[model samples]
Target: MRQAEKRAIERVASKRRNKNSSSSNDEFEAEHICIRTCGRELKCGKHRCQQMCHRGPCPSCLEAIFEEISCNCGRTVLQPPQPCGTRAPECRFDCTRPRPCGHPQVAHNCHPDDLACPKCPFLVEKGCICGKKTLKNQPCWFEEPRCGLVCGKKLKCGTHSCNKLCHRPGACEDEGISGSHCQQLCGKTRSCGHLDTERCHAPYPCKEDKPCQAKTFVTCECQHRKQEVKCSATKIEPSPQRPLLKCDDECLRLQRNARLASALNIDPQTHTNDHVPYSDTTLKLYRENPQWAHIYEREFRVFAEDRAEKRLRFKPMKAHQRAFIHSLAEDFGLDSESSDPEPHRHVCLFKTPRFVSSPMKTLAQCAKICASQDSSTQQATIANDATAIPYNALLLTNPQFGLTVEELDAALRKEYAAHPTVKFHTSFLPSDEVVLKGSGTWTSQTLEASLTALKSTLQHTVRRLKLAENVFLCSVDDSLNVLRREGGQAQREGGWSAVVGRSTGRIRMPRDR
Candidate 1:
């Protein structure tokens, strides 16, 4: 060992001198035979290695003749004699020679083909550690044969009663479904359904390979309940429609007047007021609904200071009272003159325009993810079903895509963000005044200038608005040659030149064919 170390130091010093020496004026030194490459002694002959003959001794090792490693099977391979690692049972390539060392015992018999030694951490009793079942895209964590992280924890099956052992959904905090986690115990092996950390794992794209090693794959975030790329998926343009919202039955019974229900948007058969009408607006709305006429004049019209009396009085809307907010809106409007309205009283933030995405994006989702890449590993499981992250910063925080408070905050921060855009819903209508069309003949430079002017006025009122570009979805009527400001494309000239795109003159008009 001492001699080898000394020789290595001498060789390194010699190489450094040669690299630094570039004296053209000096006489050319004859090539030294001893220093020249001495290649691996394969069966071909005691010849120097092809690589060493061209280059110097490999940087990987100090020896001129390197030992070749291979798997237990017939195939031959090359591996570093010793892996440089601090961890016990460090990973290494398999040494597959029949008779490698000068020892009497053959290498295969001593190490055995079925088991993996500490030098090469990929062995199992029956098959390859890689071939073991594991979660898709997770790292392999096999310690030795079957001894692993899973062995320590006594399994608790969630599905059955605590007395009876069975893995059930929501059975225990760490309990996973048998089918969901590939029926493998935790820590024994990784599970499937999640994305590999090395890949765009939004939509899991791979399956479990029993032959593949555990922990070699990465853990996915969307296991059990698949997670969406919170900021990436953007459907900027689509047809407009409302989802069906349902409410429970009990709340439907107490609040049962159609006129009052119509204003508060509650079913006359349902609804019990949750909050007392502190302001006078509630009092007027309580009477205005024709059905509440007797109650308005007789009971609710008179003011009572007793807090408990007021608390138990009005009706509470159902739990899923999204649609019922109209009754509250009407109530507030009814008493607008009597009391000062809240700042947002008139702004229609909910239920109007059919929101379409902005054609524009603040940043490309892929660009950001790729830019922040630390690992270049290709995660096969998530390679196919990646969700397109629109990559909008604003959209991440704001409720642009019909989001409420709960879903947005919990999403991964670095993975995606919301786009800045003006959303136009179905309730939203474009301006009535149509701009006149201009001449078809225009340069890219001219078109850009015209488009810029149109954009300024069309921008959203709030800079932080999480809406995507709704304008891109705005298409001109067909057969009418609307002036479209599309760059490079010839101003649409065919058909009845009535519809004008922004490039023409920011208006729609007709021109002769």
Candidate 2:
């Protein structure tokens, strides 16, 4: 077939899929009308909900079909909920395609299709390569990476059209990311290697020829009060998910345009294009409009947090236990001379319990180093005189500014293995290094600061959960709280005093008590 003929044939092939072929699908579309005004029809963002017109106004249409359009000028308010089709005075035209105007939105003078503003100079179509109108859906990607062309429907990324994300048209830093170099040609490329591997493993594989032939299979559309983790600060109920309505018609195309319109809220800095700010209200409306399964925005956030943290934790689990010391040292920025984390002698016993002990020598040296270099890191109110080893001492060797259980294990090994004349009994090891030189090592000022840092960290983690203000962090051990919330804060409850013993900056073995 000729190129133009093939294009026509393909476009028709795409359009044919839009028609209502089955009663089940039609019923599904009828029951739930996804508000195009919400990010998009199909690809609703399952994240935080905020300022979308759908969440703000389109509540009625969630379960309702196209009824009427309503309008109200600033001077006169339209009281009654008019039909979805009922047009009014203030707005000149509805989306040319007859999409529901979710609310009395900030009315723009120009037509939805017109990329240009009424008389605004900002609507210069200087980068109109496709020669398409400069409306919202018809975004001028040529103009800038994050364009503001608002559409009345969803926007889709066909393997061909989505040259940027799906198949990255040109070569980036990524190898074999070129169209000619997909899995078939350059399986070594990162995208090809990882994404293709994922695709191959999928029960429904993407054919080598038609990589993007796979349709949108599963989507999470959430509604109801679902809790979510947000910004390491709060547990918020994120917006619901909007499942896409599969179609091949212009309506679907228009919905896709709408999806693109409400779809992205880009952070120019990180180059992360998140779904528009989602909220519980926005999500509920989104789910009602185009109902589908969702991880829910809040749930998605929580899911992501869990995923990231698990990823963070998984590294240590994956590595050899012998490398534990190096991993912790590298993770917490520990070095040999710094804490003399170098080498020491050891006395061992069976099964290093969940909590292990280290000599005061090591702890004292760590305190001195932290005090000398990054004195600001010296937290307040540490129980230096406590019979147990300080928790921060184990953390002094953390690669990532804070300490984790992995680091403790790593540090214990680091101290013991490096000791030239190490003596180990069975599983337990104790170091003989006189880490701190002077009687002045355990100071009121030093201990106080360390304790304060621990308190501060634990408090922060609890606060992020968005519980009551009175809620203070109480954990299996405040140390676990401290360990988990390092660089964060936790809350404490009424009349509940923290044992504040040896978990966080200090370690207490079975014998230490």
Query: Which one is best on TM-score?
Result: 1
lDDT assessment of candidate 1? 0.30
Candidate that would win on lDDT? 1
Candidate 2 differs from the real structure by a C-alpha RMSD in angstroms, to one decimal, of 40.7
User: Which consecutive 10 residues in model 2 have the weakest lDDT in total?
Assistant: 346-355
- Model 2 / residue 155 / CA error / Å: 12
Root-mean-square deviation of Cα positions for candidate 1 versus the true structure, in angstroms: 33.7
Model 1 regions more than 4 Å off? 1-149, 152-436, 439-480, 483-513
Q: Give the poorly placed runs of model 2, Cα more than 4 Å off.
A: 1-125, 131-161, 164-329, 332-513
Q: Which 10-residue window in model 1 sums to the lowest lDDT?
A: 388-397
Model 2 residue 326 CA deviation (Å) reads 9.5
Backbone clash count for every predicted candidate, in the order shown: 77, 90
TM-score of 1: 0.14
**Residue range 1-513, candidate 1, lDDT tens digits:** 668856875887788567657656455663543444456653333343544244434333323434444434435355555332211232244444433222232233323345653333232233223233333322223332221222222234332112222222244333554434223222211142122222112134333333222111111221111111211111231222323333334224423332354576643223232223223343334333534333432322232222232111223233223122333333322111111122112211121111111112111222333334423335432432222111111111112434333332333221212211222112211221122122235543453344344443333422324432322211222232223322222233534332223235554233211
